[model samples]
Target: MGPTDTTHTTPLPVVLAGARGHGSWHLANIRRLQDQGVVRLAGVCELHPLDETELAAFAAEPPEQSADFGSLLDSTGARAAVICTPIQTHAELALTAAARGVHLLLEKPPAATLTDFERILTGVRDAKIACQVGFQSFGSHAVPAVRALVRTGAIGTVRGYGAAGAWVRDDAYYRRAPWAGRRRIGDTDVVDGVLTNPLAHAVATALELAGSGAAHDIASIETELFRAHDIEADDTSCVRLTTTSGLPVTAAVTLCAEQAGEPYVIVHGDRGRITFWYKQDRVLVQRAGHGPEETVHGRTDLLENLVAHLTHGTALLAPPHRTGAFMRVVEAVRNAPEPAALPSGAWHTAPALTGDGTRRVVRGIDAAVAAAADTLRLFSELGVPWALPTEVSSP
Candidate 1:
């Protein structure tokens, strides 16, 4: 249906689930939508009771609180639901929302497993309800321009790309939450770590730039996960992939960095290159014909874009469907074996170190570096078109 046809004449009331933690971000965003008259604050569904101070913050009349999803939906008279639950419950909650004929704005890593992710997709398709995944970067202003450059061959025939980011998390950080770095939820070991969490944006961006069709035919993927900390899942990972169109893409993510630095991705072609720096909010472009360097800043208007897409079938700048490619890569990475065997050192000697350190670190930094190099070399040997040294400079 066209956007105008779907646009609610009156503000549609929205019920928000998972009011604490990340859910609070959704609450604030919904409030912004309400302030703009895009949607009305119907109610909130949280596992915990709302304190008096929190309740008083709502400008709209206080909404009913319900622990149960069905009761919550009934109590609020909400037409749509925004779910920000833990990774494990996303699919079930989304399925429940779909069954209720409620549209959805679910957080990233839509489901713990590919099967569950597909199930949610099937539910959305079967129910004919509008569902948008939360990959905020997809809504960035630079996306269209970047896509245009790639489509128009501004970068010439896109040959390859690379992305990297360094994020630090201490033991206390993982201890703060029960599900911080786990690979499995219940019997299913779903890979949801740095790759699925922080680096998801980079993966989505790569797929978007590479185009949807190419994403559908991934050539190969190699990944290494490092449990460098006291987390059940890998906090550090590196992946190399080749698209069906013969374009190479590599991404490295870490929560074990000593310090935080900018996260960046660069796409290269015969004609030129385009680089995106997430931390700096800048895009640098260089072409064969152009002199010096040109840079542009990005302003992401996700909420307004989402509202427009919902109200009027306006083309979505970033749709949840594009995430499937990223999920495939994530699955491959989680399934890949560790590049090196565990160290022979006494386990007790490294108790103070992080989980991955005993094995990935105690063996020494040189060993870690060699293992990483070997992993990448194997990817290249496997026919992944990783650029030779002369093609691009390392970050």
Candidate 2:
């Protein structure tokens, strides 16, 4: 099973499920890889066939397009499936692909609940198919470099880590999808909060940096969830994950920022620290006795990694098992109390950049979020008068 293995010399046949919305990225990526002879987009499974506008961009004769996913796989004989569907549909669609012995590239925040996640994991394992979870940041080369620095004692004894993300999302963002900003849809748990949804990469990458990817690695979780928007989920949130060894990883994030900045995670050791801007695949390292060093790293596309794994003996970077600790965070958010709304006085409204409507700006949120991450304290603990104590429990 080496790169030179002749058994997999040809490009892998693949299907693109949910080929609209976020799946559109996959469609374009697949087309790009197809041109390089790494993989072939053999089929597309969508409720409706891609319209002329979407189809026109295909570089080659598009494969079969159909509404039935299982049928698409069988008909196209696709060996792999990339699923970028809704959060709730993930488990069922993934199971469908796994039952056919088709490998998978499932999107992030893997499933709606632990039960669904387990079901998908069990099915994929039983089928003996390679399943790569879609946390694209996991494929970033900078992530491993930082981890290696920590393990090599470049920063000394790891004290903990912190992450902060501030971004703006207007009414249109929530209106874009039915599940937007929802914690649960009927009996299903969406847990679409700021920490779990939009800024999840920061949280997941932090957990990975902490060397705590399994459920057992986590001892407890403390969550502070809030919303400035009229949605069912939190638009602003913070979480502290305490590992079994008592080290902490705290993250503060918001979708209703006065001014948006790049999201980042900082690994704080006793003598030094490392800051990683996950989106840019950038890293900054500072040790106790050395001047700071910064590096911008490249990323491996998850789809490309999946193809490599199938064609060669490459390891899947973001597998289901590696995301257990993250799913635990999702489970905690699901079981936690509803996100409290920020009082009107705590935030003011202003016209959004597009001049279409208004946006909520939580007063002093930027400083408050940074303080929480830097001090490894929750919002309430940081003396934010309007902030409430975090809800603490084992995840």
How far is 234's C-alpha from truth in model 1 (Å)? 0.8
Task: Write out the backbone clash pairs for model 1.
Answer: 3-312, 3-313, 227-356
Best by TM-score: 2
Pick the lDDT winner.
Answer: 2
Evaluate residue 112 in candidate 1 and report its C-alpha lDDT on the 0 to 100 scale: 74
Give the count of colliding residue pairs in each prediction.
Answer: 3, 0
lDDT (tens digit, per residue) of candidate 1 on 298-367: 6544545555666776665555577777777756655555322222341112322355422222223222
Taking all chains together, each candidate's TM-score versus the true structure is: 0.81, 0.95
In order, candidate lDDTs are: 0.65, 0.86
1-395 per-residue lDDT for model 2 (tens digits): 53322345588899999888778888888888877777888898888788778977673576899999999999999999999887888999999999999999999888988889999889998999999988888889998899899989998998898999889877778887899989889988788888887898878888988888776788999888899999999888889999998999999988888899899889998889999998899999988789989999988888888877877768888989988888888888888888989988888887877759778889889887777778788888888766776465754
Prediction RMSDs, each to the true structure? 6.6, 2.1
